[model samples]
Target: MSNNDFEKVIITIKVRGSNEEYDFEVDSKVTVEELLFKFNEFLSIHKSSVKENQRYIVMVETKHDFIDPTLTIEEAGLWEGSILILTPV
Candidate 1:
């Protein structure tokens, strides 16, 4: 693991069908899939009603492109204030 592995960034989370947005401080080393799971759990904890969409397309929202689940946040080129979305697939 490199120094960037421990880099921390603040990112915004957007879930489809829900008007709410969440901000999370996370390590850049975490994989996209892991972030998705974390957000899913967070959604359940905050507002259980917002988990209507089981299948979602997670992406770096500002980029408007679907991100690979296996790639780490840094590897995906995401930076501070990036919006990660769990949009309907």
Candidate 2:
């Protein structure tokens, strides 16, 4: 794997309208689909209230734009300290 594949970025993820925030060190090359999967995994481990069927959309907090799940983190324009929001879709 290339260095980019293993590169990590710190991002803040939060559920919409909730003050609770999660900090994750994610592989910079991760696709949005993978990121959502990771988010779900995190929720399952930390916040059990999230149901299996609960769908989420990831958005760049500052830009307020939904990220394309087909794209990798670098392709999605994510960087260190970027803030993301996971809202129910």
Candidate 3:
């Protein structure tokens, strides 16, 4: 693959309220916003639907710092093996 080819990495996420581990495919160029969107989609389909007025939280590498949902995943500096915790309200 060329350097310009999009590289995909797998991120592991543990969603609140469930014991199942979620694995997500993310492109290297994806932004934080795209990550959240992908996460939300994963929740809605593989896990549960995002409730109204519920706040979704994303934490990287078990760090307390939270990434804004509006930002793209790529902007969040997500890499391979990045752990994202999804807390649903």
Candidate 4:
């Protein structure tokens, strides 16, 4: 198949304020916004009892490039092992 999406990718995420890092396995076709939403949901569930009304932007940790939330992981040129930083917008 020519599609690269549908496959799993391991993304390492670092929140802007905190030094703690998290790794997630997500579908390559998922949009950046969706991933952020999921990550936020995860945080709300594990760390706190209530969800925060916050928005985030994803960035390439090494390159310092801001990724568009509308773009899919593959479209963003993210590979199997990608490091990302989440910053509040």
Candidate 5:
């Protein structure tokens, strides 16, 4: 595969019920767990209540679809400039 297949892409992550939107760079090889960890870190930094213990789900805004936490970015069909919504489970 070409390097572009592993290239990092910029995506927007918006937490539902909040005015916060975070721009994150992620490679297509990244897994959903890795993405969640990043979100958890962001929450911790912002002092948000949605930490690691809080059960939450990530969905693709374009498709209104829930992403499998075990899937890789590519497997999840996430491309550059994708917007994901974070909602409580």
Candidate 6:
């Protein structure tokens, strides 16, 4: 593993049909997909809730388009304070 430190970042979790806001610390090495897994664990959503092919998308900000959570922060070019909006498709 590279010694590059994954700068700490705050990720806000917003589940569909839920008005809850959960925050988590993530390293640049983490992927959005992994974050979803953590979110699933936190919300206690069954695996069946996570659909195939229609995976959730994480928006980096107001713009910048959407990105797959499966991609690491370095690959997705994410930075600290970058708001990751998790929305289910």
Off by over 4 Å in 5: 1-5, 48-52
How well does candidate 3 match the true structure in TM-score terms?
0.67
Model 6: residues >4 Å from true position, as ranges?
Answer: 1-4, 16-18, 45-54
User: Candidate 1 — which residues are off by over 4 angstroms?
Assistant: 1-5
Q: Tens digits of per-residue lDDT for model 4 on 1-89? A: 56653888988888888888888898989987788888888888888743495787788987899999899888998887798998776
lDDT of 1 by residue, 1-89 (tens): 67644988887888767788888888988887777777777777877665443567877777789888889888988889999877766
> Model 4: C-alpha RMSD to truth?
2.1
Q: What is the lDDT of residue 58 in candidate 5?
A: 89
RMSD of each: 2.6, 2.1, 3.1, 2.1, 2.2, 4.1
User: By lDDT, is 1 or 2 better?
Assistant: 2
What CA RMSD would candidate 2 show?
2.1
Q: What is the lDDT of residue 87 in candidate 6?
A: 70
Q: Please give the distance, in angstroms, between residue 67's alpha carbon in candidate 4 and its true position after superposition.
A: 0.6
- lDDT of each residue in 1-89, candidate 6, tens digit only: 56875677776766555576678788878887887777777555544655544456677655658786668876887676566666777
Worst 10 residues of 5 by lDDT: 47-56
Tell me each candidate's TM-score: 0.81, 0.85, 0.67, 0.86, 0.83, 0.66
Write the number of the candidate with greater lDDT, choosing between 1 and 5.
Answer: 5
Clashing pairs in 4: none
lDDT: worst 10-residue window of model 1: 47-56
